[model samples]
Structure formats: structure tokens, C-alpha cells
Target: MHNDCAECPADSPDDKVFAVFWETQSNCQNLVGNPHTRFLTHIMWSFVEPGEDGTVPSEFQYWSQEHIKDCILQLRMYEICIHDVYTLKCDVVVVVAYVRFGFDGIDIDDETGNMKGTHQDWLTHHGPVVVNYLQALRDGLDAIQRPDEPRYLLTWDEFPSAWDPPDPTNEHYTGCISFHEDYDGWHRCYEPRISALVDMVNVMFYNIDSGDWVYELVLKDTLPVKAAAVIPKNKIVVGACSGQGCVSDQPIGQEVYNAGNGSAFYRGSNVR
Candidate 1:
């Protein structure tokens, strides 16, 4: 006698699992339209086993060890694709690690033998390989540069908190730092060690729940102001979110005094 499992099926059906492709295009008809700016493309990859009803699997459940490895391998391949696109278009390539939960260990029978651990551990184990690959890609571009053109590598989410210097002799070879308000805690956590290694700090100012209030009260009035008084301003780069659903009415430059119904005032330029 065989018992049927409510979740897992004996064999995944071909019709049940399929990949979908999507593309977005915008018409540049106004001053806001800039052809030079490339759309920051985000490619999210995930693995799913087919369900009994022939639908894609949900993200709520834990993925198996093999599944996790396969996903990472796919992401590595996707990174190569990004390199190819970047080489052709001169557009920025940002590889985002969208995995939300833990990952299984590659060495399942290692000395410690603990299978369940945070994704960071797996990332730590495999990060060097990915970084080296990126470095080689960057070097290839640099070899053919016309001196007037500039290129850069941008990565997010999957960026590791700690790693050995890519080049021990070259301090500038240390990775760049990009920040998100959501990951402010991670920033603080890695600040002591990685701060020295960082070349530029890309401060993500978008998606903040509270606009000028948080920027003024939390960041400018508090952390950044204090940090600036102690550190260097050249280290930071402020960014804004101009995508749909983002509030564009908020003042950016010295005019931010008009942010909160002409009450609260910010006395600085947007860039600084």
C-alpha cells in the first residue's frame, strides 16, 4: 500500500513547471527621457518543483540542498550573461541575490556535519570564486578601454559582509560599498572591518517608508552628520529611487526646506 503525500508528487509533470520571460520598455518623449541611461535590469532566478496541481512551487518552504546548489550555479551563469550584456551595451550590471532563507552546505559530511545554516555561510565558501570571475571580466574590459570611457561593477543583496582582500598589494582593489536603509544594520555590523576596504559608498535613498523625516532626523541629522564630522564625505554617494510608486514630490536640493509643508527645513544640497 502506498500513501499519497499532500505536497510532493512522485514525478513532476512538464506542463506543471514552465519558465516565463518578461520584458519592459519605456518611451522617452520628454526631458525625463534619457537614452544614455540604461535600464537597470534585474534578473531573479529560483528553482521550483512541480506541485500536484501543476503549478509553480511557492517560496514559503525550505529548498533541498541540491536545489540550493542548483540555484547558485544558475546565478553564476546569469552573472556571465550580465557580463556579456555589459560588454556589448556599456550598461551597468547589478547581480542581486534574492534568496531569502538559509542554504544547505556543499560539504554535507564535513567535520562539523551541520546541514542547516544561514546562506551567508554558503556564500562565504563560494564568494571567492564569484569575485575572481567578476575581476577577470572587469580586467578584460579594462584591457580594451579607450581611456575616455569608464566601466564599473555593481552588485547588491548577495554582497558578503566579510572577505579577504582580492589583492593584498593593491588597496584600491578592495570592493566598493553600497548601502540600503533596509540593510543599515548590516552596514554597521561590517563597518569596522570592511570600511577600510570600501572605495565608494552607494547610499540607497529610495524605498524609505518615511521620506524627508527619516532622511533628516535619522540619517542627516544623526548618523551621517556625525560620521562626516569624523570621516570623509567623498566616501558616500547618495541615490534616489525614481521608479513607479516612488514619491517624486520630495525636494532634492537646497529647496528641501519645502519638504514638510514649509515647516521642516534641510540646509544642504542634494548631492552632498
Candidate 2:
């Protein structure tokens, strides 16, 4: 889902009321409870970074720790839904970053709209910053965790390739999730890049009114299947539509099952 600090003001009166409700339900009796208790962590592996002529500079970056902390505090204070229940189990924190790729410049007919290119062409042109970001974030997360510590879940929202105008067709679009081809390219590029670093991979399967086939294809046709074909089943998490606008309406367990295709695909697999 989306995270909007403005709509859900963490320090607002409404947020305070919900925060109290959340603390009660989460059994957070101690004020000094672990910060992890208040957050469901997801490591964000891609972000929108400004680029020049399809080339990303080495300087630009994603949100920093202070910014993230502010976002989290706001999330706890105003934006999160206390009655939603998912938050109670700390099922929402995600660490987000970006990858960069640069491609040989080419021109296409804006009028004809004929598309032709290999996935490799697009990926190399776009730059591999997203893949690199995933690798770094995974390492950072791993370095931070203790041996016995339960790992915080990791997720990646596929980077958008094109900017869509605001219109009826774009109502369901956030200019975020795109086509399966681009997603496949990302998976192919990223799977091997971060294979050893990450414990799981969650791909965004929602944007507008898309159906389950796309999600199924991602699992059956992409990462999960491919990973199994190579190594053992890799941990793959899917992002399904759960009716909640900014957050998921389902509980954490239900969301996990939804991501796992009703517990059929990843069932008995190590990726979960």
C-alpha cells in the first residue's frame, strides 16, 4: 500500500486516539517496548530517483534514517489504522531504496508507439542501481541482525518505467507498478544479485483493478519457479490487493497467505 504522512497526521488528535487503541491491542504495556513492536518491517529495495537523460548520477539517494524515523513516528501517531489489526503484529515497516541503470540512448516514434527491444537492453539502459540497492540493503539488514534474531521481512516495489498522465485510465494508476515484462527484467536482474543477501523477495502485485493471474504468473513463471529451478525454493513474498487503500485490510497472517497464492505455491517451501 501507499504511505502518506499528510493524510494520516501522526500527531493529530485522531492519531493519538488510534495509537492508544493500537498499544492496547498489541499488548504494548510498557512504554519502552521495542520499536520493532510498533513496526512491521519491510526493506524497500527501489525508489524514484531523478535522472539525467536516462542516466542516474552517483550522488542522488533515497530517504535517510532521520527521515525514516520521522515517517515511522508519524505512521504510529496518525496514519496507521489501529483497528486494522495488522499493525498490532508489527506487519508494516518497509525499508525502501533505489537502483540506477543507464542504456544506450534511442529514439522511438511517439505517434507510432511501436515497441521493440530485449529485456536486457532496457535493463542495461535503465542502469542496475535498483539491483545494487537491493544488495546493499540486504547486507545492511543482515549486518544489523543478531544470529538468533528473527529477520525483519524484506520487500521490493518494482520501479516504474514510464510516467502516465492523470486521466480516467490513470485513476487506478499511481505511476508505480507497470507491465510484467519490466517486472520480469527486474526479477532476472535482481534474483542473482541479491540471492545470497536476502531471505525473501516481495514483489508488488497491485496497482489498479488487476487480477490474480498476474500475481500467479509472477510466482509460477518468475522468481519462485526460477529460484527453485536453480537453487532450493527462494523466499518470495507477493504483494496482493487487500482492499485497504494505503494499508492492507487483512491481518498479517492472511496477507502472507494471499502473497503465497492461498498457501498453495510456497506451501512447505523455505521462502516463507
Candidate 3:
């Protein structure tokens, strides 16, 4: 969600969402009385930065562990419904809540404002390191799951361009199309191994030229491409942005609508 978290009307005839990355810049207090949040199954506390040395920290850097745990308590009492059309008439579904931690994979160099290493370095070196780090984080989250509550979620935000416009020249390049043109080489390095570690991935499909491209990415490219790489369709979430930073009309509202309808459509049928 955007920084203006409280502005969205409750139960509007818009797309329903499965989860949202609540920007850390937005006030958490706005969530307490907001009606629009009733549609959410998960709220991710975004942008907890990974270490420069490629490690995931046990504690959060953006907020204290206790503060986030308190926020999860606030989320425990949602009135989620089975059908968005009949939400007001539907039976109240007591949603079990847990905090979702989202991470960005890129690490920057302090001195020259460049990536710490080249694309090759990330593929051949840091890729395995990231996989191991996420595995440890997953193990930690699994350890904390209680019988009464749902397990905490670990998610990743990736550039939508990471898996598109099929790159075939390089030996390491996987078969995926190129959206950003120059990004095809980088797509070769997107580690599919990390897909199994995280609960879901939010592909940043914003600021592009067309809503159809976003739809095409979510439908034809993102799911099928990642599926070919062994990342399941259920683990992929179609991401969009609202308000200021994102351009208007670029994100197809129906993408989010389709995502929340059921298991996303891939090939001919619903996948889980």
C-alpha cells in the first residue's frame, strides 16, 4: 500500500488483494481503524534490507522486534469474508495473523554507488549465499509457528523485468523474454532456487508503458517462465502500485482481481 494508507474507501468495487506490502514510511496507527484492510490476508512489513555481506538479520533494522510483534497483535481481529461481493452479509471469518518480512536482493557499494559486484558475481557467487540465507530465515520462521497461529511469512520483491524477453545467447541464460531490453543478461542470474524458500514473491510490475504488458507478464511470462524455472504459480503475486510514484493506467486493476479470485490461471486451469 501507499503512504496514504487511510485514504482508500472500505469495500469499494475495485480489485481484491491477497496481501499488501505496507510501506514502513506509512503510519501503522492508520491500520487500526481502516476498513479497507479487511480484504487483506497478509500485510508485509516491507524493505527490511539485507546485509552488505549477504546475510539476513535475526532482528529487524526498521523497527524493534517487540514493536512488530505488537502490530501483529493488532492484526489478529480481522473480519475477512469468503466472498468480496457479499462481505457485509457473509459470516465473519476470524483470521489468524502473522508478520511478513519482505527483503530486497540488491546490495550496493558505498563508495561509487554501484553494485558491489558484477552480474556474474551475483550469479556465480552471491546467488548461493542468498539461497542459504533465505533457508536459514525460513527455518527460523518455522521454529516460531505455534499451534494457534499461522506461520510467519517470508517474501521477496523482484523487478518484473527479471524474467522476460527470453535471453538465449549466454550459456547461463534461462529462456525468458526481455522487457527492459538491457535487462536480459541480468535475468540469466535470477536464482530459481530462492523461490522455494520464500512464501511468495511480489513482482514489481509498475511504471511500465501498458497495463496489458503487466497483464501479459502476470499471465504469459511471469507464471510460465518462473514455472519452467521450477517456481510454482501459487508462489507468485502480481504487484502494482497506486497514488504518486506509479504512473496512472499502467497497472491493470483486473490482474489483482484475478489473483484474488482463486489460484491463478496458468496454461488451461487453476494451479492450486
Candidate No. with top TM-score: 3
RMSD values for the candidates in order, in angstroms, are 19.6, 15.1, 11.2
Give the per-residue lDDT of model 2 (tens digit) for 1-272: 23333342232211111011111212222322344323332222112233334443333234343343333344456434322111101111223222111110111101101113333333353325445644554565556665754443333332111212223355453221222433332222222444444443334343322344444444555545554443234344444443342132333343445544623553121111
TM-scores of the candidates are 0.32, 0.36, 0.57
Q: Where does candidate 3 have its weakest 10-residue lDDT segment?
A: 84-93
- Give candidate 3's root-mean-square deviation (CA, Å): 11.2
lDDT by residue for model 3 (43-122), tens: 54533343455444544455565565555556543433211110000011111112233221211111110033433334
- Please list the C-alpha lDDT of all candidates, in the order they appear: 0.27, 0.31, 0.44
Model 1: clashing residue pairs?
Answer: none
TM-score of 1: 0.32
Measured by lDDT, the strongest candidate is: 3
Per-residue lDDT of 5-76 in model 1, one digit per residue for the tens? 133223211111111111122221221132211221222222233343434333313434344334335433
Error of 1 at 40 (Å): 17
For model 1, give the 10-residue run with minimal summed lDDT. Answer: 105-114
Q: Is candidate 2 or candidate 3 better by lDDT?
A: 3
Clashes of 3: 6
- lDDT for 268 (candidate 1): 15
